[model samples]
Target: MGNAAHEEVIASINSQISETNALINAALVAGTPTDKLRKKLATLHGDLKTAQEFEAAGIADEQAKDEAFVLGAGTEIAASTIAAVNAELEALGVVCRIEQGGDRFAEVAHRIAVALRIHEKVREKIGEAAAAVERLETRINECAARRATITAARLDGKSSDREVNEFVALAADIDALNGLLYDARAKLDGIDDSAEKAAVERLRADMQQLVSATLIEAVTVHVAQAEIALLDGIRKLHRTGLKHAPHRGSTPRSHYLMNADLDFFCRTGALR
Candidate 1:
């Protein structure tokens, strides 16, 4: 039986013992035979004692289970593939303390696991964002070099229709790179790390400078106006994405509350 069942058994036996003692008292007051009633009370005491023992054993078994779970979770966290997660666990002082098995221990371990999972998810997205940013930077640099070459040719009075068309083509390339940057920034919507966020912002600023310079060197007012419109579009998309993005550092709690992964972890005690 479970601990609660054992407690119920103890309670029932105690009630029986109490009723038998009442009978014995009434018999004494009436000067009647009370030997059988006394024997029944003694039997009830024995039953109560057995029930209490069972309850204690059940509690011990539960404690053992808790201890095992805590130990296993600690091991898993220590060996997590994400170095940042492991470092966070260490900073939180949760390592090597799982032997303290109880509700509190379980709660702390669960919180750690949830945080680790959230961090892993964010890290993966950030990696993707970083790659996207790199691609955008590469394309922007190529466009800038091409613009510089065309501008030099124009200054030398060697400009032709083909050069004008190529210069205008740089606007299309910038538009595409802007789209890539927009996606990268979107991926960072829920990022919690300050350093990572700052790094991305710096990369964005540098890219913007390159783009502005390239557009200013446009050979005609019409082309410059078009490039400015493209830049404005990028700024609009960025502002909209940031405005609608989930609040920073809120991803962990939101994910924990709504994610099926939490249910799976609660059932299996295994990290995905």
Candidate 2:
């Protein structure tokens, strides 16, 4: 299949996935008919079938790629949900630290408000964190493309400008991220457990290495975080092996309630 076929297949499969997820939500929560669940499942099956055919005809080896999409959406959703849980737990911890129980002087509502604000900041940070990972992926892709070696003519493909820009923008604040982590480590230093501090250091080091490719470190980080973009799919489909950084755990699912954000907007680049 040509590039047009590949793009169209991607578009169609993404649309089907989005529509099916919407149907599932409506059935479960919106008082839709009971039979709609089966209809939605059938719709998913059909979309997956079409996606598989497209994979087989156009891409060289697509089983992994196709399954990766399914697995990634699932992973992204599960992981992001977990992250949110962790965030909530942390907020509760903060609340506990502050709510020492006193007269109205304690101002419990004020503490709650502060916690909520921090929660919002953390949410933005998670997006920022995901953005950082996306940038690293772009750099890796650019490096790979620079070294792109096509041994045959018919198999030729190149990176698109838009893809490069989008991926890079997601990771644009790597340096600021490093600064934030460093400050966290400093604030928590000497007061927290040494092991926890050590863990923070390890994370800081890994993130720095991911951003700094020219370093002579003993290890290189593979990108663990990525968006469900077509360029990303193409990268994986083309066998672009990542050696560092897995940011999948940092994804936020709240924005993609019902997984529509993950499927329709993210995959189709309609709301990117």
Candidate 3:
């Protein structure tokens, strides 16, 4: 029966039960035999109980339907939320893969956290890589300028005190440049992608060649024997892999120079 009709049936049964009880009470007060009225009242109460049970069952059925609809809606929302978060991650050049199942709300929340973490890490690495490249390029230009200054001085095989002092100073500047390059290359360690790392390494190689060529030019200028020895020592140390010396008690300046010399030797064939 329709819900409204079923409710009407229950109300009708309850009204009959009440009327039967009133007739039974009236017959007893009139001192008449109440057996038939009492029997009718008992039958009405039984009918009322049956009707109420059916109504209770119908209400439970309706509640179940409502809960099912809500669950379906919740599932749809969870799916859309995951899709949106995945799209955002892809825009940031990251891929998010999540296995489906379990509590959907919890899964979506976890996916969002994972996507955010990946995006932040990639951004941080990219920034570091760019900064490292910039630093290396800047130091390369600075070294080039210093080399030009030394070239213009034109010592011409002279052994004068002033010529020796100038070569010594330039050697110190070259040392400083090497340290800067090393520090810049170290920053590349933060990048995890093989292709990106390889591209930066290639650029590092090119920069190393430019700087080593500058060193070769300086050596050919016939500076003091002592200054020549100093330049040669720098080359040999790098060539023989002494640049990877232990880091105990080393200052930042020393650490930067220590790792950069190897790149110079590797690119220039200075050992040959």
lDDT of each: 0.65, 0.47, 0.60
- Where model 2 places Cα greater than 4 Å from the true spot, the runs are 61-272
lDDT of 2 by residue, 1-272 (tens): 65456777768767877776777777779777758666766777787687777666666544445445545443443344334434554563422111222222123223333333334434544565565555555655554443333212223555555655644553545445556555544443423234444544554354344323322221221112223354466455334222232333223331123456657865777964
The estimated TM-scores of all candidates read: 0.33, 0.20, 0.36
TM-score of 2: 0.20
Worst 10 residues of 3 by lDDT: 247-256
Query: What are the clash counts of all predictions, listed in order?
Result: 0, 15, 0
Tens-digit per-residue lDDT, 1-272, candidate 3: 54566799988988887888888888889999989888888888888788888888888886676555545544554556545544654564443333333364444434333333344446666686788778767776776676566656665543556755766776687678678767766767655565544554554354345335534443444345545776677566554444466443233333335345655766785742
Give per-residue lDDT, candidate 1, residue 218. 29
**Which residue pairs in candidate 1 have backbone atoms (N, alpha carbon, C) closer than 3 angstroms, thus clashing?**
none
- RMSD of every candidate to native, in Å, equals 40.5, 36.3, 40.5
Instruction: State candidate 1's TM-score.
Output: 0.33
| Model 1, span 1-272: residue lDDT tens | 86667888888888888889999999999999999998898888888888888899899987786566556654454333233333544564434222333343344445454444444546866786687778888888889899999999999999999989999999788888888778777766755666555554554354345334433442345456666976676566555555675553333333223258756877899968
